[model samples]
Target chain A: MKKILIVATIFFNINLLFAQSSIPSVDVKDINGNIFNTSQISNDGKPIIIDFWSTSCKPCIKELIAIDENYEDWKEETGVKVYAVSIDNTRSVNRVAPLVNGKGWEFEILLDVNSDFKRAMNVVNIPHRFLLDGNGKVVWQHTSYAEGDEEELYELVKKLAAGESLEEKH
Target chain B: MKKIILLFTILAFTFSSLQSQNADLGQIHGNFQMDAQLYNNDSLIGANVPSEKMGLNSYANFNYTRGKFNAGIRYEGYFPALNGFDAKNNGVGIPYKYASYTSEDLTVTVGNFYEQFGNGLVLRVYEDKALDYDYALEGVKLNYKPYKGVYIKAVYGKQRYYWNTGTGLVRGIDGEFAINDIIEKLADKKTKLTLGGSFVSKYQADKDPIYKLPENVGASAARINLYRGKFSLTGEYAYKINDPSGVNDKIYKPGEALIVNATYSQKGLGIYASAKRVDNMSFQSDRNADGKDLNINSLPDITKTHSYALLAMYPYAIQPNGEIGFQAEVIYKIKKKSLLGGKYGTTIDVNYSRVHNIQETQINDTIAIGESGSLGYNSNFFEFSKEVFFSDLNIEISRKFNKKVKATVVYQNLVFNNSVFNNGNYHKTIYSDVAIADITYKFTSRKALRTEMQWLRTNQDKGEWGMLMLEYSMPHWFFSVWDMYNYGNPEENKQVHYYYGAVGYINKANRIQIGYGRQREGVICAGGVCRYVPASNGLSVSITSSF
Candidate 1:
């Protein structure tokens, strides 16, 4: 009877673990070392842009820099904020500061050095971007970067920022 | 909290399905590819694993969608990974899982993922299934667009290693705005162009007392992509700071790496050229690193990995500590209606790449972190050293004689440093030649017979070899058999052979295959990525399905 109870307990625990594996929330820490829970970073009445990228991807850089160059102008027009997450590990951590400072970017920068945040999101490739709305609901996403893709991304962001009902794209 | 997440998943699925109901929602679609083999270890042939064996390897991706959101997962089961990738196989759970929601310009993903930045010289998180690898991050991603052609993103997460998270934490930020999207002048056809740039950085702690590494490092890049009707050019210049500790023998030289790639593509003709120079930049998770030893921050030698059997054997490994290299590839298609072109037409590809060590000096006898000028030896760029790390020169020609017959011939010359690429003793250079012929006969619209023949010759390293395969694939079933014969060897005792056969059945979303054969010993590299797999022989099976 004791063995049976122990086996039952083991299975129960495994089930519990697997159940919690879906959409696990995380206390994200940005490059500033400030811990921001999901609620703190989420936009209340506006759309949020979340880009999961690393310092080593060429295409991800292209996508990110293109947005940064016009970020100030974008915010004035749409009032949207981008939360950039870095997945660099110990070895490449040293390059983080200089690179960001030199580029003069103004996005909300965070760190996932241990990749805890990345795992929660189930990211398969860099330049992985996700769009969330005022209700903290995901609205759009894409997996790769191609020329002129940003234009499509902007049209969606603009509609969301304007508080207009989003018409699904076919 | 758990209920909320579950509700989110259900809602996301429901929404995506609603939108995709008539457009293939709830339907599964993805790519399936594999490379299997057989091995024979003859006692007199100096085989590493002397046993008759066979192996099967494959990867499959499945997706299910609802209305405004979707959930997808990848299933990869390799019964004894490919020839040289025994280490990547960790007998465990499914390697991928994720649920996402997207509507218009806003998107969110809460699960595992992958990412990267400029040239990956400073940071990159990705997965190449062909190499039996997956580097997905686990987290929540948000993407927002504020303007017509501008976008921003924020992600918080951890990287995936097999089924678990990596040791250190990872975080970053990146943004891009389109010029042509916002400016009317830039959108004109006469000067149609788009220019963008990005800055990204990662952070981790120096937990081990062995090295006083930076707590937070940021890397950035600038790029411009100009495109017209038939001509396009994209280029990015990146820079990183001095990262010193254990990886570089405690050498205090700052990690400096740069890469530039430009490509021009036309209707049937394409040209790609890239160049890179790196100095004292052995970027790795553990400062005390070993060849083929990766713990994250692995920027494989930017040098191209050749495809020819010989050139690929000793393929060049990027000298992260110091190296310079460039690669150029041109692909041209022969027009069918033009003179000198046959009825079916042909395509020709020529590619070449080479790399050498970069020179630098130590500023002080003991180089410390953050110390700028004269910290390490400095040398002129574009200089070549006595050591020729890696080089590849090859050309491939493919011609389709008819609907049932096609052939491809490749000739290549390669110089590889076994010490650098193999993480083993002895630096060996090898020369090789490879030829392949494939033909197919379609018995009906749903059934076909295909055959392939390949031969690889070498003078150094392992030996000379030949391979032949015949595949009979129909609507629901397929079978294949192949043989690899080691005909010539510099070492009389190193001549061995291998053969393998496999058959599978495909019914819509499900497929199964099984095989047994001998495996060879070599490094398998695809798309500038590589892994070492050991020789093994065993029975393998695969099954995939969706609900």
Candidate 2:
């Protein structure tokens, strides 16, 4: 009986909390090893896309490559900025810079070496994406990726850029 | 129970008041994961028959955040545990909970937490659910940033072992300083420098009958990193005081480890190299704990992590006691429309890694190498013994034939010493060659088909093996089937086929997968950490979701 009550209380709390939500503040490092808070990622009325990835995840690489191939067009269309966050631990962190340089990806890359930001975002898998509005409010989120999944992300970015509310559609 | 209810009611009322004020009360977010398997006895492959016949592992995390305050609790359930997991993890409860608050320059956490220092050579407390390994510390942690570039962290706790705390106390402190940011003058320079150091100590009362042991053992490490333009270099060294443990056969020899890595990259080419050596450096929280439990420090595995089935069969496991190894890799992209490059250009990746035992000399003519109650052996820090432990050389080429199709081919040569993995019974080294071809074709914008064909040839252990996998994926659904056959086993009856099939559905942040398969016994490794997987015929279901 006590267990049931505790579980019920948790669910009630979750319901109340989910009604008011925003992107949590977490510290991450850029490619140059400087710390910056996630709350400071706001743009001047432009949408931002954050992609969580790792060097070992194939789907993540595919998604990033696809987005990179069309990043210029996306930026031009929606005035959007993309941040590619790598959750590579120390074992593979050394390869991240070289890998990014070799691939010639133009998006800003951030390193979450210990996965602190990942846990704060409640991300369970790689290739996860979060779409934040111009105000730095998380509007939409998606996980996993198949071929051509980048199109959906771009569509949402375009919508967010047009001052459309994602609370209804998403 | 009444007090609990009253407290929850008060919290709920407070949140309601905040909601009415139109303030950003807080956010509650978490993830849920469940894996369940139903097994069938298979004596042919030496699979153990479980009386329960079914196992389930599940966890749900709940996190609440309001301004600078955050709290979380995780409920874990392991009914009968999994086949490969330790039997002690057969029950379930809320083993992890924490509350933390962050001010402008300081943060404090109470309850359970995970931490790592430097390259995790001196201390690391983490959890890996896949391996049923959870060593989160239950205590208090503090983080303070005194200056713009100086950060210090300290923690004191007892490690969680299954549902209980280990019989030891651990305390650690670490500090990191960014030299460029600290001095302010070098901040605008092109080169970056960072220095860090950590000290960790574990206390476990000595209760042995034979040899006298130190109740407290300490380890310390220092690291430095430098980065300029397209080049970066990092090095870390650690030292531990003499402490007898099970992994080292109760030897009293002190431990030491050193790791160095460097990388240089350009637009189309990247090169990376790393070297590591460890001597008697197995630091666990408990002196008698074995397997993957109570590990307080982790050694970084410099070898490449393989994802392909056949390529991963002979994965290397880091020998924490004594090993010297190095790895080098190069990735190059051929220019498009060049002689060697096609329309879409080609990517070439080559990697090589090798590990050998550290040079060891007997302390004296009277005592054998690595004997208990003695210094064990004297090792030359820079010298490598002739005894090869493991080596691998692999190359891969990927190309796009058209806009709708892409393919990759890989070949690898591996030399594995079985004596290190298996007790000493299998002392012979096995050499194997592997080949793999992976291709994916897109039928439409939302439809795709991918296939993999792999083969391995070897004369030792299980001899030769072949595998084929096909996967079809759509926007919302995916289906896959795979089969692995051991065809060249010396005993005809030993040759068997392991087949598996799975279907998955994905909706936003949620995914569900169901698979039924016959598994073959093998050692599964990730980041040089390994666990033995038992053969079983079973149906498995997995689900994960986040909000």
Q: Quick one: best lDDT, which candidate?
A: 2
For candidate 1, the lDDT comes to: 0.58
| Each candidate's interface RMSD | 15.4, 4.7
Residue B433 in candidate 2, Cα distance off native in Å:
1.1
Compare the candidates by TM-score and give the number of the best one.
2
- Positional deviation of residue B319's Cα in model 2 after best superposition, in angstroms: 0.7
For model 1, the docking class works out as incorrect
| Residue runs of model 1 more than 4 Å from their true location after superposition | A1-170, B1-66, B70-91, B94-99, B102-105, B129-132, B207-211, B281-317, B337-339, B360-376, B437-451, B544-547
TM-score of each: 0.64, 0.94
Flag clash pairs in model 2.
none
TM-score of chain B alone in model 1: 0.79
Query: Weakest 10 consecutive residues, lDDT, candidate 2 chain A?
Result: A19-28
Residue B446 in candidate 2, Cα distance off native in Å: 1.4
